[model samples]
Target: MDDEILIVDDEHETACHVREGWKVLIVDDEPEVHRITKMTLAQFIFDARPIEFLHAYTGDEAIAIMANESDIALILLDVVMETDNAGLNVVKHVRDVLQNPHVRIVLRTGQPGQAPEDDVVANYDINDYKDKTELTSQKLRTLIRASLRSYRDIRTLEHHRRGLEKVIAASKGIFEKQALKQFAEGTLEQLSALLALEESSLYTLRHNAYELRNSTLETLLSNTVLLVGDDKANPSDVVLEAMRQRQNLYRDNELVIFCNNPRHSLIFHIEGTRPLSQMDTYLLNLFTENIIIALENIRLNELLADNQREIIYRIGEIVETRSKESGLHVKRVALYCELFAKLLGLSDEKAELLKRASPLHDIGKIGIPDAVLHKPGKLDADEWEIMKTHAQIGYDMLSGSDIELFQVASQIALNHHEKWDGSGYPQGLRERNIPLEGRITALVDVFDALGSDRCYKRAWPLDKILTLIREEKGRHFDPDLVDLMLANLEHFLAIRDTYRDEFQGE
Candidate 1:
């Protein structure tokens, strides 16, 4: 309502009388125009704000003044100032060049013939055309009111359009579940700008406590935001209910919870004595709807990942069942892989993934015929070849998977039999060429094989098993990893003891 209006006329007393409760800008060829517009509008108050009269003597002066204060809602333009078409040119500047669309322009000319109504209306952007002589005081007031109302509506629409754009832009960043924090921060920034309120005065309704978002507002308001809670020790049930009900309660300055994270969310408070507006409610709901959906998607994605891990564990158990090996052998190997991954300096996430994936290193054995897998003696050539097919079988089972863990597991299953010296099966990938995961699993698998009694072979003594690993060195094992196994031989022995086959006594 404090937004200004402009009046342009040659008569000083008349201009002053017209400039009442509105802030006014006067533009005319005669200096007296400024004085009258101000005097006429002095007594009238539109919305609690008295008219501020800004004076301009000619068309050129009016354009310059308008450029500086483009927010002027209404402009009473004089047509016969300096040139007959001068007012028309100013209208063009305001609409086309300056691009100030919200201000309402009314054309007023002393000489009707010099700038005819028909011609001016057709060519110019002015809202209304009038002759100065026809303007009575009551008629002038009516014109001012109409122009101001149009200006107000236009401004409101503009503010709204900009706010929606901000919301849409912020929503784009909410593609992933974890990105809720980023989206909330962006939504808050745009909302604060659109509402024309101090950012601190805005409070978002979240779980329990309304947390202070803006740094400046947090200190200024002393962290006392809207609270529906019982006591200030922590957020209470009443406070939670108030937020869930979308009720705005301003009793004392206690923070409110607004934006929630995966578990806890961020709450920001807008500090001001003025109550929340309809626009405030509208914007807050818009942001909340977007954030809630984003958080939900994140949780859903995590659940799916966990389900996938469980499936892989089950698949590994199936492979173990194919041989005389205990199902827990797969689980024990998975744990050993994790320990080895950590010793090899893998990140926690990568180590965990390897732990889940490494158990499937023998997954192809599920495809091998039971006669060859559960054979009571060393395999003949044909049976050995059939046994070797397990590697390819395992590879085929896990290949072409979109999942990263399964993809790596497939490669390990295909190549774990290959020796470090390039003398092993399937592809015979040597030393450094072998997938590191396959290499690590090979060591663990062999150690487990030799330390435990298999249906085809007796469990060797720990000393003898260590000597076999030492003998294999670069020829059968990656020497560096071989050293690691030697150092952790007791740990490997312990795993064998822990998940030892129950049927070994038979």
Candidate 2:
């Protein structure tokens, strides 16, 4: 980056040969000073570009103009404007109070007696001090070029610092959606301040036409984006228009929002009063695109969570159908698993996953023959052996899935039938070797199975089932899980009784 050119010589002809290539602010009390400065630089265009001149007759007026326009690359301040030290005051205000460090300040005094070069240099933050009498045409152009070079350097450093902060904020927000709104607001605020724009940019987030949100208010602390005013116009609608038009209105311009949707868009104006620059447009487009990607990621995460729950519910139904029990059997098993997991002090996430996976404990029955699955009489050794394969079948059915619920479901299917005493099925795995989810589901499955009447069996009394589970502790079930279930026996029974399907018979 190069510095913005500024010519501070009070002499008009001395500033000639400088043209269109840079943004300059010429501050002189005399009107002739302004005219001579413009005429001399008129024929000499810098890089074939036109010059932008800001004129101020007094230091106070210059300060006010600079307040509104911080993009002034260079200031051609005259030491004597309204007061003997008027130019010096402007420099103090720019550097000390307003802190416009990016704008290069050059102190040019017509009468050196008013402000000495030594005092100005030591006491003030002016980048350069020059006496109007000493400045030649060559020196004037050289001063402008040097000042612009410095200005460009400072602006680049400032931009890099702000960009790093934005990336950090954005990364934090990516993992925590709650933090995203604030991050977005901070990014917008930094960009606005850096660019020295007039209007504070606004952000609106919309989902389909039903919900319109503003990023500032809703996103930071609430669920949606915070809108500035209520105009009843859909934000998403505006975004669609901008997208359809393929214009920079949504991409690079200020006063125009780059909208990804009607409900969500960033509304901001360019830093200066000037129209948006090509660079400004390009940067804003990049910003909007990044935000859109973040929003999409949030939406996708929510969808995946919902899908996980739905899959669990479907698997529960499949398990219940095979056992000749009402479908509610699956629901009861899930509730019991949740309660037991909580009793065991598992985290909410783990508990929920267990609840969803618990019902698939017998999912291997999906592979069992109806003769064995709905047998009216006790199975012979051959039939019994075939029945046990249901556990392995359940494990096989659910294995190799990337989804969390299915992964746990696979473990439960493989281990749920294994007895605590190492006397049960395919692997004969015992004790803590059984997955916690499998242990938790095993007890709940039995409780529901025993409490409910199957095609070939009658429903046992709650008291009887409770006694049976207590007696089998450490023999058929993991004792710790059994204790947890026992403590919540009534809660389990209530769920069992509630989900019992209405059985119709001939």
Candidate 3:
């Protein structure tokens, strides 16, 4: 039957280029069958695409080809090859061993008795079974078109499923990101996952929309091109031209996405060897839209946080001024707390939290009467005992709030005066019993208080303050924190100099 087939004209067979086409693998032991099949489909075009035929004469050869090529859309398998069950074995290998459920397989058999149609369809994972005699030129074309359609639809669904999974995974902790650069980098990582591109891409953020210089874009272009070694010093003329016209560019293998707001303009540059499909472009657009909204929310939340910090500091300042201490005391303590938290190996988020919360440590002093708070002479035992109530009072004022910063501040207020050896303050928390935030704020507050002038005492010399701190370690302060402060004494001194009070003299 195969010998009865006529060869296609050379002019028709070699006319069109097979650069872009659905990959079709033909597996049959008979060389004549392979040649006749190619000739019959020489002029066939499905969905505006030509067929790129890969010939594999045996089941083993077909397995090798499938192993190497991932984009094979359809396999035309002959049931009787080297062995009667060769085609059936290949089906098992592709579906079970390779775990490739996307590629469609159609079994063509010269002898239907060897592998019954109903039994093969019911027992194996083959998509369709056909007799060789019934597969004429027209039947072959129809069969291929149906198989390719199924394969294309399956691949499209699989691609979208994978892209959605990546989007969900990448967006996990993005909303909690406090810094713009961190959020931007994380957004880029998610973009990479969405597009299946490499993570090493250049991102440019232009604060001034009017200052879109070619130099900035050129730097990004150079970095991206260099990463892929694309041999171009500048971006493609299309990309440059698109930027000049203020339009987005999506090439087969490159993408330039722009996001703009009143305050900032964000540009993403990604390049790869394969062009993005329409689905990829759609997913990227959706991801970027969500990113813009997320970024706006993050910025607003950051602004709110800044305002809250300022309010807390101002309230602390009012308390300090009433107690005859400089407002700079709170500011310096905040900076010192941040530094100590970092030195103690806390994460950036936790360090910033401590910075914002430490300034309220003396807020309890608001409850102390003016006579004791403003007394110039040494406080008598009664006045001292009355003054100690401020810690409990401050904690009472700020506690019971669901806000995380306030909760932290309440802890600092309650325990900052407590001694490490159970000898100080309202609670007398000893050693590790004190909250870590309290332990940190206690050391910074005392350091700044000793160095700055107050109503009761003149500013002590740096050497005298250090001697006192060293002598009192493990008795008044956490021993490890005291050692850490001493080790990084120069940094603390820098913070003191940076936030010096205008009223240094008593």
RMSD in order of candidates: 9.4, 12.3, 5.8
| All candidates: TM-score | 0.62, 0.50, 0.79
Candidate 2 local lDDT, residue 82: 82
lDDT of 2 by residue, 1-506 (tens): 01122343343333434443456888998887677666545544443344577889899999999889867888988988788888888888898899777788888777787787888899988888987765655576777767877876777666656655554454445435423344345444544533432223323322221123444432422333334333354444344454345333633333343434433444432223444544445555555565566656655654666676677667667767767666777888888888887877887778877887776787888888998887888999999999999989988888988877788889989998888898888899889887777777778888888877665567788789878998999998999878777777777778776778554552
Model 3 — TM-score against the truth?
A: 0.79
Error of 3 at 497 (Å): 1.8
lDDT of each: 0.68, 0.68, 0.79
What does the lDDT read for residue 335 in candidate 2?
A: 89
- Model 1, residue 456: C-alpha shift (Å): 12
Which ranges of candidate 3 are over 4 A from the true structure? Answer: 2-4, 9-23, 27-31, 38-71, 79-99, 111-129, 138-142, 197-248, 251-253, 262-264, 455-457, 504-506
Residue 265 alpha-carbon offset, candidate 1, angstroms: 9.3
lDDT of 3: 0.79
lDDT of 3 by residue, 1-506 (tens): 64434634223223343547888999999898888888887776766678899999899999999999878999999988888898899999998989889889999988999999999999999899998988766667778888988998898888788777766676665565557657666665566666663222224321111113233555544343222222333455655655555556687767765665544445556666566778778777767666667767776777888999999899989998898778889999999999999999999889989999888988888889899998878999999999999999889988989999989999999999988999988877799999999888888888998898665567889999999998889999999999999999999999998888655454
For 1-506, candidate 1 gives per-residue lDDT tens digits of 01122343333223323323444566677665555555556555554444566776678988999999866878888887877778888899989999988888888777889988898889888899987776655566677767777876787677667667756765655543243344445444544443443223434332223443333432523553433222354445444544454443333433232554444334543333345555555655675677556656665665776787778778877878777676777777787778788888997777978887888888888778788888888999999999998899989999989989889899889888989999988998999899888888888888777776665557888888889999999988899998887787677667677788654554
Query: What's the count of clashing pairs in each model shown?
Result: 49, 29, 1
